[model samples]
Target: MYHTWMRYFTPSPAHHRLGLVCLGVGLQHGALPAVGPRVLDHHVAVVISAGRGWFRGADGRRRTVTAPALLWLTPGVTHHYAPDPDTGWDEAFVDFTGPATAAYADLGYLDADGPVVALTDTATARTAIGRIARAARQGNPFLEVETAAAVHELLVALRRVRADTGADGHPVLQALARDAFQPLSVIEHAARHGMTPAELRTAVRRGAGCSPKDYLLGIRLGRAKELLVGTELPVAAIARRVGYDDPAYFSRLFARRVGTAPVHFREQQCRSVPGGFTDRIPDPSRPPTIPPSAPADDGRRGGG
Candidate 1:
């Protein structure tokens, strides 16, 4: 009889590269069905949709996974997974390639040589994935925007999964990491948590291996890079958005960290386009997704 739902599909470059690189979602289900013992030729990753399963990696280690969780499997990573015979399993997956994929690698989420990394409490992630799956299936003109939003949501949810582990740091530091997207000065951030700047810096350094200022700067830079490549905003506008008042200073800072000036970075991204990265998602019907709501400023509310 029916045990699990297991279906898989590959995204075309039109959907994968142009809409959002490293962005595609699928739903899988079947009767006692599961991916057979094999290695993915492409970076195939999944988050469980329903039921329970176990993943055996190349290193001979096994990780038990359950519904509403994430599993990242890189290309050629020998692995096998199957749903429980009784309960079966359901899953959603996405395959992607792009600079953002490198970010995942930096965070140690991509392991081509070992067992799966199980992400806990992935309900939010599943929701985002589902949204992307629907978008992919519909092949909507605004598919790119939909997939981009879904990808952003997935990252936010995945980051939350890491925060919940409460490992490698104090709870307070972990909490700070969770909310690092807030636009606050280091002193202000410390004050909110009843800590002095020095104490906060020490705590973060000891626990997360980075100072609070550096952490915040990394967050800003990441956002800046996204804006530089994803949007058409001028460098000066992006600089101000990321807390740099001087465009020239922001250019230098970006160059130091990203190995290229803002303009050059944008140029390189455009030149290195993976065939479909710039194709307008062909739908004039749907409006663009609005940007995320900004946090209130420190008594600087209300723009002219």
Candidate 2:
């Protein structure tokens, strides 16, 4: 016979604005019963950590569900699944919903189009799940907000362990970010990696959830802002430093994307930078997943 432990919650309306409300969480294993050929009104991420099973989606095709796979039971979608009786399966599931789900889906973090996502490892994801379960303890008082925050952590963990990312996260994305400040067109950038523009587009979209053009612009503009506030660099010099030789064009682009001219942005933020600028900024190319292990900032200003 199967065994299971679960908890359910009904958070208040105000908590729903937190962008991810965990409705329920469960851990199960052993011989389990079959689930619906029905639909759900919200989203559930059923992560199978061990054993095997089968899943049938609205597409009317049945596919084998293996260990380290994520089943995306999304809103308005039909799903059906069951574990293999003899082998059984271990699973941890989280049910969540919010307006932010659409944005996450758009960002390539959540996709019901391919309902089953293969994972390379579930250790990290399981840790996040355990955190949710603990936060779900009755009368925790901080329950609503705590569980919701853990749900966001769980999503990031899953993204990290996706089979496509391997052990180093997204190499292509890292490389793209490293070279982002170079003055190059998207086509030219693609050529550097031995990729066609279309191929580069697909890779960036899958890894970063944005177009290559958008990704490079994000990096360039971010560096431009840092330089503006951290140094007495002229707007024209800052423009060239961030890959644009034309200060006029750079100002127009910055205004359109960041809602202000560069000089004004620097003026507004320069004085508010806590300890004020440092002698060197951390390289902006590194992924957020990689932490800076360098020594603490020496608290100097400008490059001397």
Candidate 3:
């Protein structure tokens, strides 16, 4: 026979700071009944602590899911998974949502396309999930806050696991993380790591699934978006903050890459979330605060 326990949570408004919110948590031991090849509205992370199963993703591919693995069920993605009837499994799962969840997927921390991720440290993953479950079960007045913090811990654990297992791609990713905001060209970046430009290109492409230039631009754009929404900075100031010297060129690039003007994007975000801008900017009359100084070049001239 199997044992199962689960809890669903309704997060309060204050729980939104972590950029991720726990909707529910569940723990089960033993066989799982076959679940649908249907879509879900929220993301569910199923961590298998023991035994085995099979997972089918939207692509209709069935992959064996062994213990110490994670099966990610992304929102609107059709998926079906279940433990072997004969062997069963021990599983812990958390349902969650928030802006940062999508960002994680984009950053390759979570695999939205591939459903199963083999974990190097099963105990660590299990412990993190267990903490989330325990917090949910406690039913404290601060349940939302506690669960949210635990969810962040879970994500950090996942990131560390991914990094530990990904040895070959580490240097390129590290370089990008360290210097992406600066004005270093791809060639200069490559040279810093004692690699040729072509070698660097190959490494970045293999690691990030994008060219070095594109990856760097993505970093710049992401920061620009954050600045645009969170602060009342002018277009030029926002551009410079994100490493762009010429505001006009930055505006053009932002429009082309992001599908909207910077001002429009900020306005749209403000409209979507009530008081988002006002909450960030307490006094409308005051000038926007400037970000710390960045490298002056930012490889803008090289256009790499």
Error in Å for residue 295 of model 3: 50
Best by TM-score: 2
The true-structure Cα RMSD of candidate 2 reads: 7.5
lDDT digits (tens) for residues 1-304 of candidate 1: 5533232345465555443354445666654555657876556557676778788777767678776666776666677777787777777677655546655554444445434445656677777777776776544676666666676667556656643344334676766666665657789889988999999987776445567877777877887877778788899998888877888987887898889899888888774423323435646787666699998679967679
Per-residue lDDT of model 2, residues 1-304, tens digit only:
9999999999899999999999999999998999999898999999999999999999989999999899999899899999999999999999999888888887788988889999998998899889889998768999989889888888888888899785545788888888887889999988998999999999989887899999999989988988888777799998998889789999999999999999899888845544545646477896336566987688775675
Q: In order, how many clashes per candidate?
A: 14, 0, 2
RMSD of each: 13.0, 7.5, 14.4
For each candidate, give its TM-score against the true structure: 0.53, 0.86, 0.61
Question: How much lDDT does each candidate structure score?
Answer: 0.67, 0.89, 0.80
lDDT of 1: 0.67
Question: Which ranking of candidates, highest TM-score first?
Answer: 2, 3, 1
lDDT of 3 by residue, 133-172 (tens): 7776553777887888778778667656553345334667
Better of 1 and 3 by lDDT: 3
Clashes in predicted model 2 = 0
